[model samples]
Target: MQHHRGRTRIVGALSVVVATLAATLVPTVAANAITGADFDPGHIISDLQFYDNAAMSEAEIQSFLEARVAPTGCVTSNCLAAFKMDTFTRAADRNICTEYTGGSQESAARIIYKVQRACGISARVLLVTLQKEQSLLTATAPTSWQMTASMGYGCPDTAPCDAQFYGFYNQVYKAAWQFKRYSTPDPWGTYQPGNRYIQYNPNPDCGGSWVNIRNNATAALYNYTPYQPNAASLANLYGSGGSCGAHGNRNFWTYYHGWFGDPEYGGLPGVTVTRFDVANRYESSTRISQEAFPSAPVPVVYLATGHNYPDALTAGAAAARQGGPLLLIDGASIRPVVDAELKRLRPQRIVVVGGPESVPESVVQALSAYSPSVTRVGGADRYEVSRSLALTMNPQGPVNEVFVATGSNYPDALGAGMAAGYRKVPIVLVPGTDTALDAATADFIRRLAPQKITIVGGPVSVSPGVEAQLKTFAATTRVNGANRYEVSTNLARNLYATQRPTTVYLATGLTYPDALAGSVLAARKSAALLVSHPYCIHPSTLSAITDFKVNSVTLLGGPVSLAANVKYMVRCW
Candidate 1:
């Protein structure tokens, strides 16, 4: 995020000559400074093109000029003549016009007139420094005429052609905001940091050369107001003082004299100074939050699976044994399965990991066979399963933590889950990809040490090496096949339900039908089910659940379906 600028002896020699000439020949125009009335839109455009050929295409420049002349009610001739003469000094000393190089300044003021009009701060303020220090108009000078390069004329060998002007502009903008917070007066218009400006100089105590320039400039511009030094203010605004070094230094008045020589030069009309404040604001805020992470609370996670499939059953059981909630979903049979699990595992929450296609027929028949559980069913719909689960886990309250082990393609859902998990721990991804997990994911998992890891796809999708590594961490991991109902049910029971529930159902066959049969039986028992076959319900079956008042649903791998018995329960009597 930090940019470096180079300074060499050659820039120093140029600085002396430019500064001497600027001091002698640049006659002080009227002290009142040219206002908007004096500028012409046409003139601004012509002059901008005249000084910098690339300026016309810059949107910021166009916008700025258009706004200024729109109100003046003047055409190209009058507007162009007035703006050129007043701002550029009739093109005789075109060097006074400088191009903004910093991404921010360049973005804000593509053209000098645009910058002036938008900021209500003068381009002259920036131009004066460019004229005295870098001779911006001269092609002979290096392209690093930008204020972002470095302090002084000498470009450093490291960043020989970088500009540092935008960096300074960024500092001032931040200072303006901070000042706005504490005081009503617009600091951007008057308050200047002169003391800290001197301190930032590499040789502040050597000869007071920078100080003299600052003082003289302030005197000539704002008549030298009684300004005190505030190092903390500068640091807070510009991020200087400690390890950040000169780039972080906001002690403007002390660091550079080019800013305050003429009030007319300092204030441009079109530029919105606030744009530069974004970088500092974002950095400072993120940094402070990162520092407070260690003291946060911990969160509990629940893993769920489809009914009776040995693999999923094994994974869920392992998770439950590790003190994490493991639930099984089998269509309308989920309640009894949940009840049974509640008695055995006694988890605090429940979560369903598979999709609607996994809903079991026996479970649906069992629901149809019973009246009380049927009444609570509220008609099975894919959305209902997800909604019901959401209500059960959250229960009109905010969830502090959530961990999703779904596929990588579900970025939106993954992001939401990660945000929830962020309250207590960082979001980490276990090795689910065929290739090794990237550094970021590995690092996050290492940091979190989550008690339970959910595998969205079957074990086949997860690298064996990753699974082995996860087992070594002493964390319980649950692997679920691709079933939306199972996924949603498991998540809900673990996160929102009044109490965690678990029930085990044995699948007789390893094929898809057996998995469905087990899921039905588990559902009949009111327990969350975990299955490991592709025979889960179809997407239509899953979508039908949206009509019901069910909870959340998670669809694992693929190939889904709903049997006739399960359809009866999902559709209701």
Candidate 2:
């Protein structure tokens, strides 16, 4: 349990180990003398885009940590033990909940997952630090000293080690929270993209160098350690005494490389389309989707008429799951963007959603020029069209879940559809009236026999009668708010109740074109779409921003659809 010359140790036996560390360990300050040329700004420690652009779910983080084999020193030969230690639960307001999974909550993996999500920090980086600072991760039986100062966060070389920060949860939570604070823009914040003066040792004699931090994550690491490794120090991985060089940052880089390849991973391919001044909303929506998912020779593509919302409401999930984009068309002639996108995609099959009235036969025939395998899934009406699309996408088997939205309105269904898309579930269109479900919808519900039904919108959009009818088919839960803005917020909250969304998409509630196309992209990005007014953001949407602390916001459409001032407000929020 002794805190050696440059390493922090966590012992199981608290009192005995603390005395041992205090008596045996002499405070050793490592020098950080290095040249500015030694630094590579492009070679970041971690890429924020990896979290923002990629679909990093809680399950993914847990699985990654659990997959690692047990290190050399664990007494039980358990890798998860490395992440677990006794902690004062309520100390310093660090109340980590025990309940992560259902029934009986347990496991160190759960604790790491919760803290990582809560602080918006990567779990990969946390584990690397635990290993780098203490070797507690691989120790035969970690001492209380190592567990207490698990992250070596508060135990700086220049000052006395803080006693109040003792305990596993406190160390990890505070350390992760500090990393987040570093990324933030403040006068004291050091982890911004710029050249930072890092010292090798606390002593002025041990000169340091200026290193250019490429990204926030790399800058965050520098802010934590305030040092850069010299060539001599990095030459030997385990050796300590070498020309007054820091080992913390060096070990972190090496450990991360050995375990997870490159820490700065790639992001999803991004594309942007120009908003034409004369082009209608339908054309704009199609163009946006086409640019977003520019996969050539796609297997399938979803086509929905842009005049109404019902048919397109449920198409997002299916399109996202299939790695396809959602395209909007007029009732008769195909929009220029639609026609151009169809040519670019060259999909094997085009699935036209909606009735003949919504998307006419002429449009279906016009699609023959692009692909020979064009298939129309039109129904008797909008409700029937939704049913047909659902049946086609999910098939006639037991579905995981289904979303029921008011067929009459667009706002409730817009956000609901995006959520369903992200969840990869089917959404059914129900009558907006305060009455029984439509025959087509009811018949489809009975046929598919879903496990859960999420009804979107208030009583006016989807009445109690529909809820009762849905309950007979599956476990029903209604998500409603005072208005469409509130309803969108509620939908986002329900979908990502436990974790924050990777990014948020803000589109105008007055129009459907921007969000309709953005929904498919949002699902692919694993993001939440929140609809607001053209001029200002709703209070409910603002509440969501505060709750989740969402920093990334992508404004759908141009200033006309969502005002520039509104976009600014949303982003600043």
Candidate 3:
């Protein structure tokens, strides 16, 4: 039944042909061909039993065949199989008269339907098999022997075809029965799941791969042809390029796709999404932490200044290490989101990471409502706040590494936050657009004595003088981009080297609060946090998502903060 010419021999669970093709082989002229086997191996070819064959009439199959214009020059609606297939009374015909509608011409469609019902095989399978084996359906001028072995029922390449199974009715019925037998249990059955050593070609030297058969239809195809297309064969569509590769299965896929759209239609693999529904980013972070760290108790939650970016900028590292989310609050009082999350988390202690000025004493009093133990680590200004937070997180000694960003702007700091959090290293803020490092930041950097320091933004945000000063304390490395979006994408790429995260978070790059709170959430899940515009995804960010193959994306804020179109564009990836 394999589409090959000459010297066919059955050798140890393989049906192979030892001769060359009959020159009729040609490449299918089509665009968007499946150049590679990227599809899931378990994909179903078709739902064989999904079609209602009983409702199908002979007139329908005949009309369908007649409508298809043949490859050879022939009169419209006239072909050899349609007009002259039923020349003799076969075993299928007797049953067709008894069970199916009795016909006088013994039409081609009637034989196919009778064989389909008789052997419990699909008519579509028979039609495809017929064309595949002998080009019977599309060939305008076929030889008498071609019709005799229309389905290649009894043809063996080693010898002449067995004459007993000659004629269209016998061929179709026997072929359908053979396909049915493949699905049944037997010692000779090749359609079974397990490690199957399928050869790439008839030549023993060509070698093969171990394929794990997942379904009956794919098994049947392999059982019929007994060869798989190798990588070289697939590289060029026209032919195997003399590299001893089989084309039967490859042609089957190509033809099936051309005839019908995705052969594995409804059985494709699915993506998984983990969602967090909260009133704001405050609750969003807690919900994210709760989901990500389900078993971790005694979490060390970081309380940051919601009004400004200073306190929150340096808190990512500590929160990540403690397996907790950043809880943002107003300078005066605790937000309800933080209050509810505190009760839910029931942390042993809270590390408030800002000064009394940045996070007032009233907020500290309100935090004590949930936890009896609350420690405040802050200073007189933003730079001192960053220094105090770092020192508190690493009280034993100076940390080995730290990320430095502009205290005035949120983008650069937020861009570097998630990565810093993942590494559990603090983010120290420097004065933005300043000619030199402020006295507090400089003094703090000299004390910490970090081995490595990453400058997040360009010279415009943190000047060369500050970077040079930072270099005096540590091995300074700058991560700069043309803009904020590029910076975020570059940082994400560096953080998640080869790991493709299933979930990623997206927030507007133009603003900060949404992304500031979102950074901790994304870091907790070991996911990437990307920044984009309100209405559109940045090109570089979108490219990263596609390359990573991220399944689901969490938009940090509502439509106002991150526009509806941004979510739509991300989901499209």
Candidate 4:
């Protein structure tokens, strides 16, 4: 059963005459007092069948009554006496035996009396018909009436007696309303209201026998004296007496139920209240997730540099030969060396990788002559070179191809190539210290294939055999020397100026992670820096310098910078 709080009704003031009449009636008259119309005397009589069958004792009845009654504020001895009389009168009606077939009827009468005295309507008005049908005490013989009572209907002992059943709480509410309808017309009226009467006789044609039964039922229930009719008193009566009162004693009845059950009762609609509570519970239990990208089809590119042309070769290789139509360049200027390699391997772009001082006037002049498309990019003091062999490469887009410039004289190219791959840019490393063709270079040529390889460094480390293996892969070969800072700065300037896939490799000895981090910080664009020694600075300092756009910082090895650079790069990424 879905439990809910029910509504409440208020009683009005009582008149002096009614109070006087109620006071004179004592035990015999009190049982007939009116409480309300819906009290169902017939149902009461029926329910009492269980009590009559010895199922419930007198003590239990008294206890039930006491538990259900609300305390009345009436302090006068007369009022107290009247109240006691009414209680006894109802008890007697409920306790009728064989010596009194009508005893149960008397008990029904007394109940109505107390209800009317205490609540203000006759028992008939309260619908207490059960009192007429069954005795309050146990019956020795089983009867159809008892069966009907058990089924919630109170059937009178006489012919044409039909069963009438009403739940206990529902009766109380009906009784309260009956009292209200009766009281409103003449606030002090002792007579039952004609408008609220019900004809219960099956043979209504028999001079309205049902009306007499109803009248007698009314008299038996509400025998109380009427006084000032108070709505508060009535509310207390309805809230405290009858089935609602009994349920209240059991702690089951609540105000919400009454409000919805009774049209006159007050409260918000039941369904709405329930829904509000459910919604609150749902909101408390759930959460939501969000996606990183809402749009699509944007390009992402990575650039790398070669050993000799550390920065340029890496960038060029990333942009051209490794991918597609995009351009890559190697900035190193060993043109004869790079051109021969370029002719043999044919990289899509050539970026001359070098330090700040590496771009000499002569080399620049040669580049101007050979590939005027080669553009100087980055800051004035430190710039790298971007040689667009063909199509212009956009640094911001995704990288697909790679180009490489190699030479035997510069062992840095191998490190540059590895660094490029770390940046997700694929590359080819070329070998040759000069523009010469040698078997050693040929061996280097053999080693530079399908991507992965290790180039061990040593004093005077350009292994000719390694150069030969590198030649097999060298798309372009360039040679030049410049300070690490100049190379980095030039790379940054050129990247900003041309906005192409570019790389700047710092010269071995001069490049420091700290200085490179600082340059990166200063140039907040998309330029990639290839620092040979990332360990020259503390990890914390490097962290702060490369905090933004950290993806652009690539580490190359320096003699003293190896361990720290390795540690920082491994952890930071």
lDDT scores of the candidates, listed in order: 0.30, 0.65, 0.64, 0.27
* Ten-residue stretch with the least lDDT total in model 2: 22-31
lDDT of 2 at 268: 20
lDDT of 2 by residue, 201-304 (tens): 54456677777766777776766766665555545443442546566666666555455444444322231212222135766666557556767888888888
Tens-place lDDT per residue, model 3, 1-573, is 432221122223122111212223222212244654633333335433212133233554665465443344444323534554434433443322223343566677777867665666656566656665666556665667667787776665445777788877777766666665566555235546567878877778978778887767667666666767777555644354245656656655554445433455321134232224344556655665565556535557778876777677777766776677777776687766667777877877888877777788888887887777899987777777777777766776577888998988788988877777777777788786788887777887777778899999899988998888888888998888898888888888877787776577887787767677667777777888888876556678778777778767776765455542354343222
lDDT of 1 by residue, 160-253 (tens): 4433334434322322222222222323323233532233223334211123323223422221111222233233332222321232112222
| Weakest 10 consecutive residues of candidate 4 by summed lDDT | 284-293
Off by over 4 Å in 3: 1-277, 570-573
Tens digits of per-residue lDDT for model 4, 317-391: 333223311112233444243343233333333344344454444554554433324444322211123222111
Ranking by lDDT: 2, 3, 1, 4
lDDT of 4 at 194: 32
Better of 3 and 4 by TM-score: 3
Which candidate model has the greater lDDT, 3 or 4? 3
Query: Model 4 Cα RMSD, Å?
Result: 36.4
Instruction: State which candidate has the highest lDDT.
Output: 2
Better of 2 and 4 by TM-score: 2
Backbone collisions counted per model = 138, 17, 2, 152
Q: RMSD to the native, candidate 2? A: 21.3
Candidate 1: segments with Cα more than 4 A from true spot: 1-16, 19-110, 138-201, 204-573
